[model samples]
Target chain A: MKKLKLTVAFDDGDYVVYAKLHYDRAPNLIAAIEKVVPFSNPVRHARICESEWMLSTPYLGVEDENFSYPDPGDISLHRAGPHFCGWYERISPIGTTDIFASVASEDLEEYRKKMGRAWEHPGAKMTVDIVEVDA
Target chain B: MNPIAQELFETGDRYLMERPEDIAAMRSRMGTRGQNMTVQIYAFSALGSSVDAMYLLQEAVAKDDYDFDTVVKFAVDWLSTLAPPADGSQGAAIIGHRASVHYRLDQLADLTSRASAALKQATTRAEVREILQALEHYYNQVRTWIDLEFPWHELAVKYAELMGDPAPRPAP
Candidate 1:
């Protein structure tokens, strides 16, 4: 099986998250993302669903955008910038995004809880590093 | 005015007024999905407002859904026939420079080709829908591009004259 994955390491690389790019489903987005391998960012946590879901908008200069209604653990690529919105609950975007990747390894509920608890500490931040996860 | 140009003006106006409102709702419900999808949809929806009637006719008459594929192939094939981008800051160039447009359009071509390939291999409806979402977004980009530079007749004529390809065929 062909597996194309990205490692999103955060919190000083302590929390390692692995996601698989659905190249077959979102070829344009995957292709655009593949060009900019090793996309990483450290941004203030802005909870979208839980008290922990990180909202990041790192511009990767890619133009392949989409409207993606994703389930829990799915990651969306915003239109212009390299924004990320990870779904952590029974939630769906009112519209859609370039839903390019999915978090397959980590437990969504657990990740959310951990992130929620960690966020309680003042000045808590999440550094997300997305790199190619070779299979 | 040609029907294409007329339609473009009318279509663009409708979306320009309507989509912005939808954007807020979408953003509120879906986070950045609103921020991203609305920009894409409105831009294209505006452009689709004024598509070339002939192209629309072709799309209507065609037996297969080759619209996306055809558009991608045209953008790529036409660009390949020209010289590569010249040296300079990509942003420094005039917003409407042929080379600059080609540079970005080339990227757009790659994006569309990838989407087309993915659609061919997609299995589930969910997968197919996402692929379509991406395709429509990019496809609108080309349209939005046109919408930005309205009165395309001048641009079209100038393109023909500069490229010296009066008979350059567009993909069907």
Candidate 2:
């Protein structure tokens, strides 16, 4: 199955939090993310793009209704859902660097607008990268 | 170590043994005369209900936190008042089937108690393993009985699938 990688950066002083995402089962993964993200209806914002076969949740301040991308595969919140929605991929041929470039190029303008001053800061970085991994 | 759990286990065991005898005697009194389809059907339904109660008792014991004794006592008292007195016309075949089910239910009750005790004392991997083994045996036995008794039931097929057993063959 195709898997996505996500690298998120937030300004909480010295420490930067990076999350990688992989959802083996979409429904369960959606439930897990909802627990962490504050949203009225998380699933609706987190749309599954059929064309790219990727799952995406809205960024913290993104205003667009249809800016869906592949989900960043992270599973730190084990008890967030009924079960684990991601597993480690040992033989992922797709490099993270290439996927990161595409996501940055495609969504950088939206990311800048939403993040404001944080987007321009040297440390202000958030990435949503998709990488295909051996199932 | 809830007193209720032990009480439920004992009560369930006693019912399994006593109820069948009561039904059998009622069958004898009717002198094997009338068909009494209503009584026969009730006896069959009671047998099925008792088996279900036994399984629930096992589940309560497995859960270990519930006051199973009180739950079981209430069930037994309710069943006693609700079940119709056995009529003598009920055939031996029906009685035999009920008896067998009661026996299995009793065995399951015993297994549940033992398994629960093992779980309570399980501080090590080996102890957990032993408890799991006991549970597995109990589950397999119940699954086999259910599959045979209700081959056409959708839940039976679902159970078989969950256990990785082949779907039951269509009734011949």
Worst 10 residues of 1 chain A by lDDT: A117-126
- Tell me how far the alpha carbon of residue B80 in candidate 2 is from the true structure, in angstroms, after superposition: 2.8
Q: How much is the lDDT of residue B87 in candidate 1?
A: 23
**Docking class for candidate 1:** incorrect
Candidate 1 per-residue lDDT, tens place, B1-172, comes to 3232233233333332123232233223322443333344443443343223222322332334545455433432322222122222122322233211322334333333444444444444444434333333333334433333233234456778889868422211
lDDT top scorer: 1
Residue-level lDDT for A72 in candidate 1: 72
Question: Model 1, residue B48: what's the lDDT?
Answer: 48
Tell me what TM-score chain A of model 2 achieves.
0.21
TM-scores, each model vs. reference: 0.36, 0.21
Per-residue lDDT over A9-107 for candidate 1, one digit per residue giving the tens place of the 0 to 100 score:
444555555667777667776665556444333322332343224433322334445555778777776543124666645554566667777766456
Global lDDT of model 2: 0.32
Tell me the number of clashing residue pairs for each predicted model: 9, 10
Worst 10 residues of 2 chain A by lDDT: A41-50
Residue-level lDDT for B138 in candidate 2: 27
lDDT (10s digit) by residue, model 2, range A28-97: 4443344434211100001111111111122111111221233332232211011111212112322121
